[model samples]
Structure formats: structure tokens, C-alpha cells
Target: MTSATRPYGTRERRRSIGSQGESRGGGEERTGPAASEGQEATAILERARAAVDPELRAAVDSLPRRMRRVARYHFGWEHADGTPAAENAGKAIRPALVLAAATALGGPAARAAAVRAAAAVELVHNFTLLHDDVMDRDTTRRHRATAWTVFGDADAILAGDALQARALGMLAEDPHPAAAAAAARLAACVVELCEGQGTDTALEKRAPAEVTLDEVLVMAEAKTGALIGCACAVGALYAGAAPEDVDALDAFGREAGLAFQLIDDVIGIWGDPGHTGKPAGADLAARKKSLPVAAALASGTPAAGELAELYARPHVPEDPDDLDRTALAVERAGGRAWAQDQAADRMSRAMDELARAIPDPESAGGLLSLAEFVTRRST
Candidate 1:
């Protein structure tokens, strides 16, 4: 395969800049070449999470007692026993994107103004995760039993609903001048997310051969891209950026989110269970119409036919050999290759969109670094 066509693990691509400092705030600055882009992105995200977590916690705490406990546990803030645990929480990528976009458009001060928007995005993201776990019948997340598995389906769903309401409530109650527009944008994004999910569930009922790449990509963009875009746009809105600039940032986030989802699909099939917090071949076992599987099924290659036959089996494969065969079939059908190409292409296009918003490439270094981290991270 050519450089652009090669799969994710094949080679490294140098596409963006890196950071050197722990703070994006006023601090000792090193201008020259610094840490790896991945490390910088991680540092930036850590900082963003630290800045946003308090506000996020406050929002979650505002829920009813039962819902709050489930939300707290789901957020890795407490154990099932109602005890505090030093457990892994989500990466907070959505909130980080919001903050980074704000800083990119205005400055570090802009992040403070946009914090509510950041918190709202994070809440909505977790809400989706809670509902998604139930819908997918996923038993585990973040290396622990999913909320639905531990709290029962009704509570889990109710908790998710509470988070969604809280997210919109935050935006609605914000004193920021753009709060109304932000709320409207977020509400629309939720609608798109639901429609995308409906499409996904519908796809699951159809024969694999009947699904098209376009359909899957559209679904992925809606389910994943919409919120990320909204997060970025809200940040720009909070910063008082022009509508065109907001639109550009939204486009940037949408493209990056699409790339992120594509890589996630790849990880779903091939990632280490220990690292990914899921079983090997979990998406395949569920027969999920993930981006890679859809690509493979639509490839029209001989391997595609065999893959379809495997998927057409009466039940999900239980034998290790059968599961292995299914994975191999996806790769042989060119699904893996197609997804990798699309991810890279989307990342490149995301850069283009960022450029449209922030003319100076240096101004967008933080956002670019985050985008690189999303599309290039190992897990």
C-alpha cells in the first residue's frame, strides 16, 4: 500500500506541531521543538480535564440522589460501593476540544468563558455512552462493569436522560451571550445523534451485503461528528467569534470526529482487550455494522462475499477459530485499508477546516495537536 493507503499501524505520519509546557496559561514558554505530538496532546488534555472536571462534577451532582450516584460511578468518580476510587475516567476529549477551540480563537481567558460549554459537551458525551452501552448490550466500560449492568437498565437509562437534560440545562442557564444559540445547537446535535443511532440499529437488522459505505459514513458523522462539531462551535460562539469562523471550527471538529470514529472502529476489531477495555473481536462478535465492517461488506471483492457469509451465520460465532476467521475476512476484504485511508483523509481535511478558521497555522497548533492525538493514538 502507498503511504496514504497504508493501515494505521504501518507507519507514523508527521502532520502537526507539539507543545512543551504543562499550562496553556502564562508560564515559562519554550518556543523551539519540544515533546512528541502525542505527549503534548496528552498534556493538553490533562490540563483541560483538570480545568473542566469541577464544573462537570457540579453539574452531575445537581441530579437526584439515585441518578447522581449512578452518574458519579459512571464517571469513575466513585465505586459501586459508594466509596471514592482512584479509577480511570473518560479521556475528556470532547471537553478538551471545546477548550482548545476557545483558546485557539481567543486566548486562555476564552477557555474560562467557555467552561460551561465544555462541561455541557462532556455531560452529553457521557449521556450517550450510558445509553449506548445499554443499546449495544455492552457489559463493560473503562475496565469495569457498565452502569446498565450494575445499576439495572431502567436506572442506567434514566441516568443518561438526566445527564442529557443537565447538559442542555447548563447551556440554557449560562449567562454568556451565546448561551441561547449554544443550547439550540446542542439540542439539534442530540437529535442528529439519535437519528444516527436509529440508523445504526436499523443497519444491524439488515443483511451486511445491503449496507453501503455512504450510509455507514453518514451514520458515523451524525452519531459521532455532530456533538464534537457542536462542542467546537459552542466554544467559538462563547469567544464571540464570527459566524463564519464558528462554522469553520465546526467543520474542523466534524472531520476530526469522523476520523476518530473510523480509528475507533479499527480498534474495536483489532485492539488489545486489556488496553481497549473490551473483549477481542467484540464488535465482530456483536456483528456491529461498524465502519470497517461496512467498508469490507461493500468492497465487492471476493473476500467481501466470504465475510458476508460469516456474518450471515445463524448466531454470533463462539469458537475462537470462527471469530478469528471473521476478523481475517474483514482485513482481506480491504475494510481495514479503506478505513485507514478515510481516517487520514478526514484528518487532512480537518486541518484544512482549521486553517479556514485560524489563518495562522501556529495559532491552530493546539487544536491540530489534539486532532492528531485523536486520529493517531494507539488506544
Candidate 2:
């Protein structure tokens, strides 16, 4: 379907979806519960991470010594001197989604059943991060030097490859009745993720005018959504849930992942350096064809023309003010507004799919809260 005809494109439909959590009888707002319950859901995520971290560490430790050192350092588990560090690792959102999906469908027992799937997803997630840091020439991640910057580029790439292999190996060796199916699904997701990354790199080589909003959206789905969707599906598969339910959870994760990426792109350009752990207007400085940039260029507004002219220059804008101006131009060209609307629309659709998967909205509290957390600016 065209963007204009999509369920989330129209303001009226957007408003209707926004009110889905309200009390139909008295018009009472459900926002309060959603916020409180989102905290509860976040707590659940922490618990899942606690349960999965040891296994994750063990998986990393199983690699060859050199690879293990690089992986451990990348995971913030060790310092450059090979000593342990107290630094935090990733947010562990993908694995948390897996455990949450399983819990939502089959409770605590299902969480246990899905633990291997959770670990596998987390591994795949970090694998992507390692490769992404190299491809983007990113110097810092988690407020420290990226693996490729500290170690050699080849080692970083090898570590990422090993992680990907380990992820599939974990699933392949799983004793769960659904292991084979889960592994197959995850393998397909990896392929899609690669395709997405390829498309993203190809778009960067093109002039802004040559890209389309649809093309960017498709890339976002492939790059971010595919793995997230796979994470959720893996959980359902471990529980032996019906195929329809598995598909519903997958759809929900895909939508939530898109929303997450939309906001992430915004943060990439305009978020506080202290909070985001990156320079201000990082995306603009890199001339990366993020969603906001694509939307602005496609707007055909005068501001878009100005922004395009700025980007076409040979050197990236080194002056902070110039980068700020470029960011403002993007906003004025309607890119910011478009991306925010798309994130909201995706969140609404995600909730719809969650409802379909779980049937009882109240019973899906953890899933609902997690979904809300993904879309919100503040966690």
C-alpha cells in the first residue's frame, strides 16, 4: 500500500489508535497505568538480562583466546589490559523481547524454555554492532573505543563472524523441540539483515534526491526489524505456540523495531552527546542517509534544497553551527515531523498486533509496557 493509504498515515486514524488504551465507558485515560506498568516491564527486562548474562559470557569465553579477548572488551567485560571492568554492556533489549514474548505466552516456565533463544538473539545483536561500528568508522561505542578501533579491523570482523556463527550454533544444538525451526527462522533473518545493510550502504553512495521514503523504510525493516521480529518469533516457537500467534508476535516486534530505529535516527542527529554517547548532529556530519535526511530530501521543500546543497559539498561540515543549521533545515523540510509521526504509527500498529497475539490486553502488560518503552523518548 502507498504511504498515504497506510493505517498510520492519516491524522484521524492516528488519533483513533492513540486512544486504544482508554476506557470506552468513562473515557478514563490509560496512560498512567501504561507508564507504571512500563517500569514494571523494564524491571522484568533487567531480570531476564541477569538470567542470560552468565550464559552470554560463557559463549564469548568459548571462542579462541584472541577472539575472546576482543569480544570481551567489546562487551565491556574487560579492559584493554585484559582486566575485568565494571562498565555496562548493551541494553539487552533483543533478548529481553524474547523472554518477554515467551513469558507473555507461557509464563515463567516458558522463559526458561526460551533462554537459549534469548542468548542466541543477544549474540546476533552484538555481532551486528561489531560489524556496524567498523562499517560506519565509529570510534566509540558504549562510551569507549569500538573494537575495530582498539583491535585491528580484521579481528573485529572475525569476532563478529564468530558471534554470528555461535548464535546459529546455539540454536542448532538446542534440545528444544522447536530448535530446528527457530534456527531456520533466525538464519533467514540474518540474510535479511545483510540485505538491509547492503541497501543502506548503497543509499549512502547515491545523491539524496535519488532515494525514496519507501526505500528507506524497507531498509529499516530489514536492518533493525528482521532480527527483532526473529527474537519474538523464537520465543513463541520455543513455547510451541500456534503459527498464527508466532506470526503476530513477529509482526509486533517488527513494528516496534521500526519505531525504535526512527527515534534512534532522530537521536543520531540531534540528541545530547552526554546522553546519546555520540557527537551532536553525528548523522548529519557523516552525511549518513538516515530516515530524517531521506524524508527531508524527498519533501521537495526549499529547506530540502538547501539541505541537499549543504550535503553535496565535498567535505562534511566541521563547524558545529553548520551542522546545527543542516539539522534545522531537515526539520523545517518536514523530516522530523514525518519521522515522529511514523514512529507513533508504528507503535500503534505494534500494539494492535500484540493484542491479536495475546487476546487479553490486560494479560499482555509486560509486552504493552515494553512496546511503550521502545517508542518513548525517555526510558
Candidate 3:
């Protein structure tokens, strides 16, 4: 990209970020919560969302009427009753990665050309969210009632299936040379994601001590890393990058995605309801074996033993107030710190992979900023 349109300055921006994204106050537009996180990264996400929305909306509009309504409501484009509502669609991070990856390797023209591919990726992501909410029994998403709760499980599920089909169909109709390969990779990602979700569900059913850290991490990579990797690889393909560079971008995205999942699991436990759109300590209440909990269980500390006992309790209606002890146990077992360290390490690996793909710091700044933005999400 030209200097006039570049998201970052000449200096490298891949610095250490903690549980929150570093905010340098770069005259950013402050579009929303996403904007509040970081200047350059949020701007890239906002622009990518803007570019992809029309295509996404058009694709949704093509669905059958009831399905269209569900899609619109889930995407936060309309109320459950079908009236216009404020947009609560997510920050568009995945799609932004697509555009940023393309721009890094090719330029603005590549980014522009990849908009359809970006929208396709976002569709696949939302499809998974819709299904995940149902399986996880999650009531909230994007700070609103999840589709399964608002519309019913059957409707929400059918809508999710439709969305997945729509994603592939969108790509099938595209004339871009890269479109076919992108579709194939995305389809394969869905398979891996399903297996990952399956593993997560199975783990939750077992005794806390029965699950291993490696098992959870593997599931996380499949469930989260696969799609993010596909998004970046798709963008690289659109950019006409060499095969090795495309693979490097895929690796970069997978590492960053694992970090994203680590932070998300952290938020699942300790997040503020106002920001996370879910009740605090919800994961603990559910006794879900998140990465932090898994680490704590494996720590062999006295607190780890306490956490194991807490998790072994049978399922009951959750009282959020009852989780303080459990959360404290996990923290005392060093779960929180371990997850944070692992997240930072994963991001370091991500930066390395990114450097392999785009060696010039100037060309790489956009991707680096985004990787930090994802990992740095704070509760």
C-alpha cells in the first residue's frame, strides 16, 4: 500500500501488548468499542466491515424470508421483529485480516478485489457462532439474545446451516482465480471446526482431572485457529502470493488465533458483563473446561485440587455468586498467569510467521497490529 493509505507508519508496531490493546491515540475516529481498543487496528477493521457489509447483506437478503430475518437479526442489522436496529455486528476482525493480508502482499488493488472473499469468510464465522451458541447453551452474543434463544433452536440451526451454504455458494459464483481454492479451504476448515467443537463438548462431560492441557490446546487450534488460518490464506491467494508465502500467512493466522482463543477464554471467566455481554464467571458456573481451568487442573497445586473438586460437582442451575471461590482457586493455581503467558508466546510466534511471509516491516505493520489487537482483548 502507498504511504498515504498505509495503516501504520514506517516504524515497526509489533510491540508487547498485555491483556488490553495498547492505545496510542493516533487521531482515530473512535467508531465504537472496537475503535476504543486500538487506533490503527480498529481503523482497519472498520474499513473492512464497511467494505464487506453490502455484500454480506445482499447474500442474506437472498435467503428465504424467515431465514433472512434470522440472518438479519443475528447480524444485528434488524430487530427480531424485523425493524431496523443499530448495528451490533462484531468488529470484523477476520475479514480485516483477509484484506490486510492481501494488502501486505499485493497492495490496495488486491485488498479491493478480495472484498467478496472477505465477506465469504465472515459468513462462515457467523455460521459457526450461530451453531456454537446453540450447542453451548449460550444466551447472549454480540450483547444481544443469541439466535437460538430469540428465534428457537430449530430456526437458529437451520439459519446457521443456510449461512454455511451461502458462504460456499458466494465463493462458487465468484470469478476470481483464487475463489475455488478459497472455498475448498473454507469447507475443510468447517470440518476441522466441527471436530474441535466435538472435542470441547466431550471434554466438558469428563472429570476435570481427566482432560489434559494438550487436548484442550489441540481442540482450540482446530476450533479457532483453523478458520483464522483459512482467512489469511484466502487473502494471500487473492494477492497472488507464492505458495510458501500463503502457507506462512496461514501459520501466522493460526498462532494469532490460538492467542485470541486464550484471551477469549480469560474473558469467559473474568469479563465484565457490560463489555463481554455475558455474565461474569459464566465459564466457572458452567464448569466448562476452558484453557485456564485446564492449566489450573494440571498445575498440581493445592488450589488445583480444590478446582478439581469444584468442577466435579454435578450440573445445576448456576448462581453467578457461587463462582467466586472457584475462580479464585483457578487464579491461585496460576491458571490466569499461565494463560496470559501462553497468549503472549503465541503472539510472538505469530509475528515470526508474519515476518516470514511479509519481510518488510512497512508491509507487515497492518497484520502485526491486528495480531496484537486480537490477543490484547481485555475483560
Candidate 4:
């Protein structure tokens, strides 16, 4: 239903994140148990979450009845109660990047086009999530049944199509020249994302030992970093910033996106079920060729032998005992360590990009913190 008819809690959760989002300062150095002392990214993420508008609730509510069901499932609106609520909704990093770049360029918060641009970025993000679940054959997402699991893949795909259309519509109608430019960049990024996914799927067919770190990095940058960079650049453009300034923000966004994906790789391998909302070693069970798995296979470690066998198997193991065996094989192969190092390197680059992008220490502080936040998150 429409936002007016929806419960305040649902709207608030979808439109704006909870205050706990501000606590993301933990996980600075993931190796240690203790969290980081300083905070920068947490604040920016909080702001982004606050500014995020509930898309399915607002935009999808007006769709045809069949289309609405598809959209609602993706947003966790029509799902049964006691289902898992998403932790942090990914920090609203992309939208925040957009807004932060805008503020750095001296733009006011009242800029309507910038707000719409921010919302558009988030819609694209969720759209990707919907398709990702189906592609991965994932049963659960955000600790609940995935859209494809409940509504079927066809419906979920249609929902993604609708959200994508809405994103373009928002950008086209935007009053600001800069926002429009940024939206165009975002559209280009979507094309790049599709290309990267194609490459990634192709790479999976080849032996992991054949895939180099450089190739993996290329895929990661295109599939994940492009959109993130667009978020920052779009924010800057919306603020009427110069091209050079927007490019710098773009650099920051790309690095930050890489860092974000690297950490995701780690979580996919070793994250706790309670926190990750999935079974431990979930990625390994799925034979996902993520950054870590690719590296370990390239190393030709014994873990690689195990990984190879796991991939060659006719079917996924149904028994928990067999699944755990596969998990140990991946861990033994050095996938975990390799992924962690990649994440650290990506984080360093993200910080470097942020530092160089904005000269003013105060304005850059939030961006800097956001980079750190992406690196250290558990889920």
C-alpha cells in the first residue's frame, strides 16, 4: 500500500535506518576483537540512512496489483512476521556518498533533485539484490526467504525491471543539471555491472587456478565499484561541482566499493550465522568464486584440490556433515587469509582516494570514516 496507509515503523525502517547504524565504527581492524576508537563512516552512513526514502513503499505502491506483489517481496513488506530484519541495510553507503559529495560542494540539503538522485541510487542497489538472489539460487536474504523463493524468479526479475525504470524516471525528471548528469553516469554504471557479472559467470567455468588476482580485481572494480563511484560523482554533480571535483569523488567511490566487496567476500566465507543470517560457510557451499576462493585456487594450495573436487561434484551436498567438510576445505586453502589481505589493500586505496578528493579536512572526515566502516563490518 501507499506510505500514508503503511505503518509508521515499516516506513521508518525502509525510508530511514535505526540509530544503531551510527554504531558501525566497530570492525576497523577485523583481525582484533576490539573495535576502532575513532568514527567517521558511521556518522555519514547514519545520515545516508536518514535521507533514504522507502522506494517500494513509495514508488512501487502505485504499480499494478501483480507488480506490487513482486516489489513488496523484494522490500520485505509483505513477508510474515518474526522474519529477520536486515542489519544496517548496507549502511546506505552509495546514497551517503552522493550526499556527502554534494555537501562538500556547498549544496544545501533542501535540493530536491539531489534527494531524488539519492533515492534512485538505493533503488538500483535493491534491484541488484533481487536479481543476485535468483542468480545465486539463494533461499534466504537478510535472514528471510528471498524474493525468488517466495514470489518466484520471474516475478522477482520483473520487480527488478520496474525498479530500474523508476530510477531512470527519477533522474530524467530531476530539475538539477548536475543530478541529471550524475544519473546518466549511474545508467552507464548499470551497463558496466551487467558486463562484469557476465565475466564473473564465465570465470566460474574455468579452473580457479587459472584466474589471477588482477583479473578478479578487474571484475570487482567493474561489478561493484562502478556504481559506488557514480554515487559520489552524482552527489558532487548535484551540488553544481566542477568536473574535476566530481571525478575525484568518483575515484573515492570506486575504491570504497572495492573495499566494501572485499569485506563482503570475507563475511561470505566466515561470518557467524547469527549475524550474517545465513549458514556458516554459505559461500563455500555454493561454490561461489569470490575474491578469496579465486585467490586460494590460484595459489594451488591443497585447499584448491578440495575446492576443485567440490566444484566437480554432480550435486550440492545435502548433509550438514558433507557441507562442513567442504567448508574446512575452503578455509584450509587460504581463501580466508587471501580475502582479508585484499580487503585491507582495498581499504587503504579507499582512504587514499578520499583524502585526495576533498581538501577540507572537515568535509572529508565523514568520507574517510565511511571507507573504514565498509572494511570492518561483520555483515
Candidate 5:
């Protein structure tokens, strides 16, 4: 799998990065490269959450009471009972990208000015998550019951629609000069996201051999990259960045987002369930044609044939042996390495785009940290 880290998720860390950095040798402690990036990214996410939460809460509060209740539960701000619950909402990755991009070009003042836009971007991300959960029939999110399960499918779907509307509404009401442009970009991104998701669903229903790597990559970009790129582009707009610079930042984000998805697919198959929330092999059970599985199916290796046979029917969680064999087949067929290499390549491109806009390494540190966090060496 690619060595990328996670971006969005406020799900509790079963173990801390600090624990990884514990004294491994002499009394002097040291953090590995991955742990260091995790620490920096964690700091950036915390700051983003602090800056964006008030605006986010205010937008949710404006919803009709029923939608508000659903939204609150989805965000982990309240329990199903409507009682206050201080669960982690998310890690604020998209909002952090907004603020980081704004700060990279326009500094602290621009970062402050972009908070509302950041909130709006975050809202749209959660909107996607809600709808995604419904469409995917996902039972767990952020380490708890999905909104659809707790509130019913209709409420979850309606809340997702409300969140999307409120996100645009937030942008429309913003007095900032860049608000209009940001909203336009975000709206287009939402359309791209929907298109990608539709393509993914369509691909999953097809026989595994019918899918192609390129098609899956394009769909992944549309489903995942579009919003992340929009977040950065929106930030660049908020910062009064030149059009070319905005485009560069958008490219940077799109590439990084693709890398993030590649690693996510890897984790879906092999990551520790305690760390990832979702059970191991769940993607295979669902027969989701995620990137690695697609690559494995496309490979001409003998294990590819084995994997295809395994995927002919969904692997039951009760049959851990079958799931394990399927995962091994994917690895043996070079799917894991291919996905990791692609993630690294995408990140390299993202860095090039980032450098095109902000030449100074220091100026790009926050965004860099986030990108590295996204590309963590989990494999």
C-alpha cells in the first residue's frame, strides 16, 4: 500500500502518535518520519477545527429542527437521543486545507478571513459522507453507528441534502469579496463528486474483469479529489490569489486527494480494524471495486485469476479464511505495490503543483504536512 496518511477523521485514535514516538533506544526519544508527520498534521487539524467549528455549528443550527437533529448526530456533536455527546466530529482535513492554502498565499490575516469559507467546505464534505453512508450501506463511521442506522435512511438522506444547501447558503451570505467565487467552485465540485460516486456504483455492479484501472482512477478522482481540490481552490480564492495560483493549488489538492484514496483502499483491506473503524475485508465483502482490487483484477498474474474467483461471490465475514486468501491474492498479483507506487507518483505531482504556486518550502509547510499525512506509509 502507499505510504500516505489520513486527512479527514476525528475518530478516536486507538493509539496515539506519541506512543509510536516513544523511546526506542537511548533515553532520548525519537519520532519516526511517519510519526512526525502525524504529529504535525494533527496540530494543523486541531487548529483548523478550532477556527472553523463555530461557523460550522452556526450553519447547522440554522437548519430545520429535524434536519438539525440528524446533522448533529452525524457530526458526533450529539447522541441519537439529542443529548449532548462530545464525540469527535472529524479531523477537519478539508478545512485545514482551506486555511493552509489561504495562509500559504495570504498569511495569517487571510487565514482568519477564510474561516467561513473553510466551514462551508467542511460542511460539504460531511454532506458527502452522509450521502455516501446511505448509498454504501455503511454501518460504522467515525467509530460509531452511521446516521442512517440511528436516524433512518430518509432522515439521513434529507439531512445530507440540508447540509449541502446550508453549505452553499453559508457562502452566499458571507460578506467576503471572494465568497461568490468560492461558492461557484464548491458547487461544481459537488457535481463532480456525484458523477464520480455514480460511476463507482456502476463499476461495482459489473463483473470484476469488466473494470479497468484508468476508469477506476478517474472515478476515484471525481468522487474524492474534486472536493479536496475545491477546498484548496476555495481557500486560494479567499486569499485573493492570482488565477494561475488558484489553479495550481487546485491541481495540488486533486493529486493529493487521489493519493489519499489509494491509501484508503489499501487500509480498507489490510489495516487494523481498531485503527480504521471499518472491519478488515469489509470492502471485499461488499464487492466494492476499489482501486487495488481493480488493479489486481486487471493484472495478468495467476493470483489475479484467484482473486477474481474469490470475488465472484461476496466473502462472508464468517469466512475469514476466504477473505484472507483474497487479500493475499491481491498482494501477490502486485495490486498493493501498484497502488502504493501510484500514490507516491500522484503526491510527487501534487508537490510540483504546490511548488509552482508557493516556491518556499517553509511557506508550504502546513500543506506539505497535510499531504505527507495523507501519504503515510501504512503499507
Candidate 6:
């Protein structure tokens, strides 16, 4: 595939500078080039979570046995090998987005209500992942067996459902109007996520070549972008920011969310096993219609022909050679380059939206740094 096959429209080009056309060498750490930035982001994320309300901790603790156990296991509170260890949990990007958006809008007091809102969003995210694992028949999450793999599918589903309930329950705990709005937004995003997931699953059974870039973007925005935007807007609402600012934050979150998904798609294809906890080219082996693959297939280049032939082959477990061929096919089809460009562009838009949302240099600088962190992260 070549740039000639790319379906990027005028608007997309206008908003992004594209990537620097640099190809990452095999076995290189995803974030090795940006090690310092990753460390900084990791540190900031830890400090923020460390300051979380004790009440929130208690709320998490008060979960029922089954739900709590699954939550603890999924959050890296337990070891992947079934031993005990306090490994780092998720990066908590969504919650951090909430808090940073809140702080940027006003003082911490005004956004105090956002603490619960952030927690609620995080719970909702974990809930989705639990169910997603079951649907995808995924054995692992965060390098550990998924809840459904360890427990029965029924039990995992129930736990996910319970977590969703807890998120809403937490939102409703506060009688404040902002709490109500946040709850409403969260509910809406969940519903949209379900719809997007359905579409994504259906697409897998069909030809990846038939899928367009626009449809992929729609699915990505709905499934992944919605929650991210909700996190930011919820934060702004809890902080009592102006309606205009809240809307701007929503846009910023949406763009950032898009960038996040693009990077995740890249990792799903090319990421190191040590960092991503999944084998390289997992998406290709699964025949999932990820962005890069979708674009390559649609381009109908020689690389696309190779992918078509591979897809037509009998279903079997892919080995290293097959994975390497798949990766090379995608690259020749111009997939990797196009995807990297899109990620960079989306990140730029995210930053621009943030600037418009929060003009304060000091706080906006933090959000900007966070945006850079997201774009540059390897895992």
C-alpha cells in the first residue's frame, strides 16, 4: 500500500501534521525513545491517585466478596502468577483527566465533587473490560487471566454488572445537580459503548477490506472516545465551570480519546510483549478489523492482496513467522505510517482543544503535558 491508497479527507489533513515517518525497529521498547516522559507521566499519575479520597477507598473496599475479588484481581492488586504482589494498577488516565480538567477550570474545592465522579468513571471502565474479556474470549487482562477465565463467565458477567451499578450508585450518592448530570452522561456513554462494541464484533465476521476508515473512526469514537470525553466534562461540571468551558473540555477529551485508541491499536499490532502483556500482532491473528489492518485492506494494494490470501487460509494459531509476514504486509500497504500520522494529528487536535478550553497557562500547561504523555506513551 502507498499514500495514494489512503482515504484521509481534507479535514483530517488540515488538523494534523502527521507523524515524522520514522519506523520503529523490532524489539525496541515502545516508549524507549520517550523514557523520561513516560517516567514523568507515571510519577504524576501515582501522586494523583495517592491523594484519592479515603472515602473512595472505603467505597471500593465495601464491594461484595465476588465483585471486590474480581476488581482486586483486575487492578493488579494480586499477582498474575497467582501469588501476592502489589503491582502497579492502570495508569488511571480517565480519572486523571477528570481531576486535571477540574483543577484547570477552578480551584480544587470547586472540583471536590469530581473526586467521586472520577472514581465512578474508573469503575465503569473496569466493568466494561470485564465484560469485554468474556465477549472476546480473552484469557488475560493487564497480564493476568481475565475474570471470566479464572471464574466462570456467569460470575464475571455478574461482577461487571455489579461494578456498573456501583458506578451509578456512587454518582447518585451526592444529591448535587452536578452529580446528576455526571450520572446521566456516564449512562449515555455506556449505552453508546454497547452499540459500538456490537458493531465492532459484527465487523469481525465480515471482510476487513470492506470496512472504511470513516466507519472505524466512528466505532473508535463511540466505544473509546465517549467515556474519555465524559470523564473530562464530568470533571468540568463538578468544578462548576462555565457551560462553554465544559463543551470545550469535551472536545479536547474526544480528540485525546481518539489518539488514545489509535495508539492502543498500534500496540495491539506491534507492541512488545513485556509492556503490553500480549503477543505482537495479536489483532492480526485474531482477524480483528483494527485501524491499520482496515486501512491496509481497503487500500487494495499488493500488501492488501497478501492479507486477503492469509485471511482465506485455514484458521490456525499464528506463529512468529506468520506474525512477521503480517506486520510486513501492513507496512508495505502503508498502514503503519498512516496510523502513526493519524495518532500524531489527533494528539495535536487534542492539545488545541485543551488550549481553547482552559486558557490559564499554568493549569493548561499540565493538561498539555498530559496530552504529550498520552501521545508519547508506549504501553
Sort order, lDDT high to low = 5, 3, 1, 2, 6, 4
What clash count does candidate 1 reach? 0
Q: Write the per-residue lDDT of candidate 1 for residues 50-124, one digit (tens) a residue.
A: 999999999998998999999999999999988998678888888898998889898878889888889999999
TM-score of each: 0.90, 0.90, 0.90, 0.81, 0.91, 0.87
RMSD of each: 6.4, 5.2, 5.3, 9.7, 5.8, 5.2
Off by over 4 Å in 3: 1-16, 21-37, 314-321
Per-residue accuracy of model 4 over 1-379 as CA lDDT, tens digit each: 2112321122222211111122344533333322341244566677667666564257767667776776665666564332433433445777877777777665566334477788888888878878877886778877777878877889888888888888878788767766567767889988888878778777767765577778888999998998888888888788777788778788878877886786677667666677667666777766767887777776677777877787666335666666666656766887766666555555555555555556555676555556555665554
In candidate 5, stretches whose alpha carbon ends up further than 4 angstroms from where it belongs are 1-30, 377-379
Q: TM-score for model 6?
A: 0.87
The better candidate by TM-score, 3 or 6, is 3
Report the lDDT tens digits of candidate 6 across residue range 1-379.
Answer: 1122222132343322223123345333244534554566677576557655354455656788766676667777755344556765677888877877887886677556577888888888888998888998889777777878887798789878988898899889877679988898899989988887887877777776567878988889888888888888888898887888888888888887887777777778887667667777778788777888877777768888997777666336635588778878888888777787787767666666676667555776545556566755555
Q: How accurate locally is residue 194 in candidate 2, as Cα lDDT from 0 to 100?
A: 88
Residue 269 alpha-carbon offset, candidate 4, angstroms = 1.1
Candidate 1 wrong stretches, greater than 4 Å:
1-35, 314-318
Query: Candidate 6: deviation at residue 238, Å?
Result: 1.3
**For model 2, which pairs clash?**
none
Point out the worst 10-residue segment of candidate 3 by lDDT: 1-10
Counting clashing residue pairs in each candidate, in order, gives 0, 0, 0, 2, 12, 2
The alpha-carbon deviation from the true structure for residue 284 of candidate 1, after best TM-score superposition, in angstroms, is 1.1
| Candidate 6 lDDT (Cα, 0 to 1) | 0.73
lDDT winner, 2 or 6:
2
What's the lDDT of the predicted structure labeled candidate 1? 0.83
